[model samples]
Target: MVNSWWRRSARALAIALLLSFAAPALAADDAADEVGYQFSTDWTGPHTAVWLRHLARFMKKPDIHGLEIGCFEGRSSIWFMERIATHESSTMSCIDVFTDAIEARFDNNIEVAGFSDRMKKHKGYSQDVLRKLDYASFDFIYIDGCHLASCVLTDAVLAWDLLKPGGMIIFDDYVWALEKAKTQRPKVAIDAFMTVYANHIRVRERGYQVIIEKLAPRSDRELVGKPVVHSEEWEKDYEKKKKD
Candidate 1:
């Protein structure tokens, strides 16, 4: 009986040591899986997927506050909600004009694309209202609504103001290709903002999005420069292989 008891205690000690060594790695793997799975649900397409993988690595640290400008059907919003819910200490807010703000531009195409119903369902700011009572305030903001330059610019400014210091502001569709020949693309607005506020900005995954740590006062010297473009060496190689 004494021998059996000694062996049981030894087994328990061994298990404890194993857990002490493995816990951190297990936690890291879970965090990585969370990022991959969450991003996959929000972003599709090859380029966006690639960008998201890198962005996930950057966001391993938990964000205290979060925001999303376009909460279409709440796919991305749901992702943020999960993050906030799990962390218990984080907050997220979302905004959307929801009903196709640029009806004249993508009306026919949007229907053909089968996004009409989805757009219609996004008509209200219900998610944001619900979240206000559900979670804490946001520390990160994501802008994905109103692709038009003017509207995007306005949202960007508002998001900047809303972001807390050390918070991140993310702009979706910042590098979108526009159909209008006369109107400038949304990138123009993003570039204009970055041109004046480059120091606070960091290009994530080759400029698919911009991450700003906080909003700061702009200066003439800062305004005079242009937006910094991230090198696309890997992307170029990938494209070349696809062509080949």
Candidate 2:
């Protein structure tokens, strides 16, 4: 079992390394360049030319739905609205505390970009807002809410249930260091989540941002004599078993 785990880890690492080199080329989108977006900060720019563009190629469908955990000034949110969520049926939802007059700027940016009609703004903590969202409804989920490991883990776990099968989840700032302790960083929580869901997801990119694509539902269910389960159901059952 240990050897098998090592093999899988090595394979995943190899793929990640290869993807890193090809990421820039794969992310090139001519249409995305056509948009005249407005943003005060450049935090999300470093990522846009790479994995974000690559993601747009695969997940940009007519009915694509996206959720963002931390939207500051609508920088990354605007990218999704203009790039991936281009279809009339496509929609984007953002969760943020909107402190420090950030929401006004976010709102203005979205409005200026002509994406106000397609966006849903949830002004609250991610932990609270994510709970109220629909499960398995989002084709893409971007987590950049809190920098702490505990908060990051909570966001990832909650977001997993909200993501549809084959959906993509992007965790930002995997290597960020606001706290001195390693346990306080987002990498620790992201690594833990990845380790737990290793069998259920495919790691697509590993850099400043970590991207994973959901392969199967985390809960279990059965249909037409076939045994199947979604991850959310499995989590509930696990909790119930623990209680019993």
- Candidate 1 root-mean-square deviation in Å: 18.1
True-vs-predicted CA distance for residue 66, candidate 2, Å: 0.7
Query: What stretches of model 2 exceed 4 Å from their correct place?
Result: 1-38, 58-60, 218-244
RMSD of 2: 15.9
Q: What TM-score against the true fold does each predicted structure earn?
A: 0.49, 0.73
Candidate 1 lDDT by residue in tens digits, 37-144: 211132522234443443343343453555666654345544443333224444445455544543232344233323333332223443333333222234666777
Model number with the top lDDT = 2
lDDT of each: 0.51, 0.80
**Who wins the TM-score comparison?**
2
Per-residue CA lDDT of candidate 2, range 46-143, in tens?
88866555576644478889999999888788777767777878899999998667888788668756778899999999999999999889988999
